[model samples]
Target: MCGKRWILDNKTLLREYIKKYRYFSLNNVVQSIGIKRCVAIKYLQLFKSEKIVFSAGRGFYTSEGREFIYPKISRVIKIRQLIIKEFPNLDFIIWNTLYFQPYYHHQQTHNITVVEVEYDGIQSVVEIISRFYRNVITESKRKLCTSEFDITNDPIIVRPFIRRSPRDGNEPRLEKMLVDIYIINYKYKIMADVDFWELWRSLFSLYRIDFSKLIDYAVGRRNMRVLISQLIDNAGLKEVIFDSKYDLLSNMTRKKGGRCRDGKTRHKTVGIIEKRNTI
Candidate 1:
């Protein structure tokens, strides 16, 4: 009877810990609750059975309890397959603006889909895709080209990132998509501050964001981290800021000792948090 009581107590503790963190790794649980790594794994498995936690990736677990979902842009898979069939050896990632629709409250319709490839392969890939589809354009630093497609049809844009890494699949991961959206906004300035705040709030509320992956992508862009932290504060997502894995990153972006230069410790900006429609 005493052994059963101890087991129940540990299970309660584990659930509370998961509730606090929202997302965690195996090491996090072990250190937080002073349990053996193997024991923690068993507890996580039990939690999975109860739908209290689910695996986010190889070693990541989250209490979100839902499958990761991205926007469904029409013909995205067909476009990806065409690129793979034509250039089997080249690496590329295909995504569209719609992937970000869930985060922003305002519904912004994008008529173009993006296919990111190697910088040197941009023109060649664009040429190949153009042969197969109409209204294809290549985006470059020197000039921006408008797509010929109207509101009825979707246009395709072929571009490249400043730095590219090996991706396992044709679709970009969630972290990559989030970072890329910020980069795109920097270049295009299409999204307003209100849009960004809504996006951050929705993302934290709906999914378990992997801070390590996000930070890896934002290595040179430290300001992005600071901006994200500010958005979290403005959105009143204190729980996310207090998450164990993200606490350090969130704190670093704040003014020292939580006070700004003007001696204000709280965020000044506020934005609407609502579910935006995705096309």
Candidate 2:
């Protein structure tokens, strides 16, 4: 009876773990839970068969119905890994639309991937990627602005920007993704106003956004302060703005070199913050 109870409890624990974490590797489960490797594999197989969990490439698994559908960018992971292996000295951030998957629901019919590297190495990196994938083509700055679409060849947009923060592996963090999306929307004018707001609402609701990190990234960018301020107001997430550990409004004002508005002064900001926390 004790052995049977242990088995049942382990199964329940595994289910709860997957539900909370959303994704896990087989080794992660075995090491963290102290389950024997073979036993863990068997349990995982059972879970998969029962539709409680699903495989997410190799040994990774995610809870059923909760798995995020990463955007389709062919060989993205492999390409990133290869780049790191070949160029140990280079600093770059490689990601596709997969980073924004959690914020919006859409089919990835267009193949647009961005490879951002240091300012000097843009052409070199593009050449390297093209060598690896023969069909891939680099878009020129003029072409990026003027050309609408290219369905014939695989297009990899190469951009050179000053690397602000260290690469967080091969992917940018959520804060970086948000800032990038904001910039892209401003430059491309692709996302509709309603769609943009809906995306922001979904992101704020689903993720623990680091407002400080976001502000840090957006500080130097032109019109970013206004964009963020408007987003906060339009989302009706005034409570989030006030509850954030950093004084968001003051930070924006300082960045913009503007005097604080009546409701945006330090004392008023503090009062609003306190009021929201109390509620």
Candidate 3:
């Protein structure tokens, strides 16, 4: 699609249009610019390279530099296809460490594929996956942290699905993946003493994270402490906290174990937490 062609004569008009609209889709650009979809896409890629336009999500663009890096779902698609071939009705989410490669410092040589299934179907899914793949561990916390289960060897960890996990279809949303990585690092030291704050900073700087959804999922996993710490340390993130609808950080600081104002634990669902206090 990015093949060499006549230089975009409409680049200035495209920039002005995006600046005025703030948020737009590919079709919107095509209609407004009166250009072929492929031609517009090629120009858009050029604009993105020049840091003139940013990806808000799939087929979505913004003038603001906050680019939303969508996870590459080819592997997830293949795994889902395989799982669906046998258990056509099973509920699961498939994600891998490779999605995070864009935000991290070093190019990761090792990858971990995480397959999360509902309680009853965990074993079945693991069994099905084990047939095609090696080093499959089923809900084994010890195995994840042990030397015997080398993560560098490309291991597959099957976990029980969290209720109401934030997702983009069958794969985790960026928010859910961020929370999961923090919790995984806390529990199993999976990232191996890597600087998490920097990791999160890179992620937040690159993607359009839904703070409310991220916090909600973190609370569900009982892993808000790490997030809270990162926010406290970074003044810019604290500003984001105030800007976001998720003002529960103050209340969270007062209450332990992710309790709400009514003294009940936070719900598993995202974007449902009511605002109580400001931080």
Candidate 4:
């Protein structure tokens, strides 16, 4: 572990704490978080990578000046966690059943975090994981992966690969089921960019993580995005679309009471004479 320390995930009052305030201001952003001023600033910098907020003026001001606005749109992490937490077991059920894949069990987990922060307000953090195969490459190309038709600029996103750990096998551990799911659904722009600095500020204050490398690498937003893209492929997603009309028809009709649709017009079967004869 690096000389830096990270806080353990705090299980208490996730909502109550978030609701009290929306963003932490400069006067408070540093003071509020226990980390040294420099470290706190570093965390805040990370949140900026997700584009959750921006500086309002010179010097530190608030989460707003420092910029820590939360996303207004509902995101998968909040939505899924909220729904699952209601049932307790249902939460794990949904995550493991739908989100978590078998291959994820082996690799380390990395979070694509987004934070929307405001100065002196409660800050929100969103974490996402890639649901597809993210191959590891020697060099990283950030912009291609991070920026996607305004997606990286969006309030929430990224295809965070499974956390990497020492692996005996050379194989890239990606979930087959996830590859299938991402190809068909839940695979758009990797939910790109959340407020990273706010998260560092907020989370770092309460807890700690070895974020030095992450902080440095994530600085170049485009580089981060491109690097992330290599881990997952958006091009392969086309496979989700059917190649044959027969397959499309089968998909449309195979379900019970599924919306019945026909691509081809039955020229002969719909002869007007048939209806006239019946009348």
Q: Model 1, range 150-242, lDDT digits (tens) per residue?
A: 433556768775453323477776666666666656555556867866776677677766554554455433335454555456654455444
Preferred candidate (TM-score higher): 1 or 3? 1
Candidate 2 residue 146 Cα shift, in angstroms, is 3.7
List the global CA lDDT of all models.
0.64, 0.60, 0.67, 0.28
Those runs of model 1 whose alpha carbons end farther than 4 Å from true positions after fitting are: 1-4, 19-21, 24-42, 45-51, 55-61, 132-156, 161-168, 220-224, 234-237, 243-247, 250-279
What TM-score, over all chains together, does every model reach?
Answer: 0.66, 0.56, 0.62, 0.18
Write candidate 3's Cα lDDT for 1-279 as tens digits: 343233445666677776776445676778877878887888789988998877654455656566456666575667788888988888889898788776666666777788888778988888888888888877543344355457677888888888879897777888888777776666556565455556777776655655556666676666665565555565246433334323345422223347678987754332223332111
Residue 98 in model 1: lDDT: 77
Sort by TM-score, best first: what order? 1, 3, 2, 4
In candidate 4, stretches whose alpha carbon ends up further than 4 angstroms from where it belongs are 1-20, 60-279
Which candidate, 2 or 4, would have the higher lDDT against the true structure?
2
Which of the numbered candidates is closest to the native, going by highest TM-score?
1
Superposed Cα deviation of residue 94, candidate 4 (Å): 53
Which stretches of candidate 3 lie above 4 Å from their native place?
1-67, 71-75, 140-148, 192-194, 234-236, 242-279
lDDT of 2 at 107: 32
Count clashes in each candidate, considering only residues at least 3 apart in sequence or on different chains: 0, 0, 0, 59
In angstroms, the error of model 4 at 106 is 60
lDDT of 2 by residue, 93-195 (tens): 8777545655664533444466777767777787788787754544444445326435334356677653553236656666676666676666555556676
Task: Show pairs that collide, candidate 1.
Answer: none
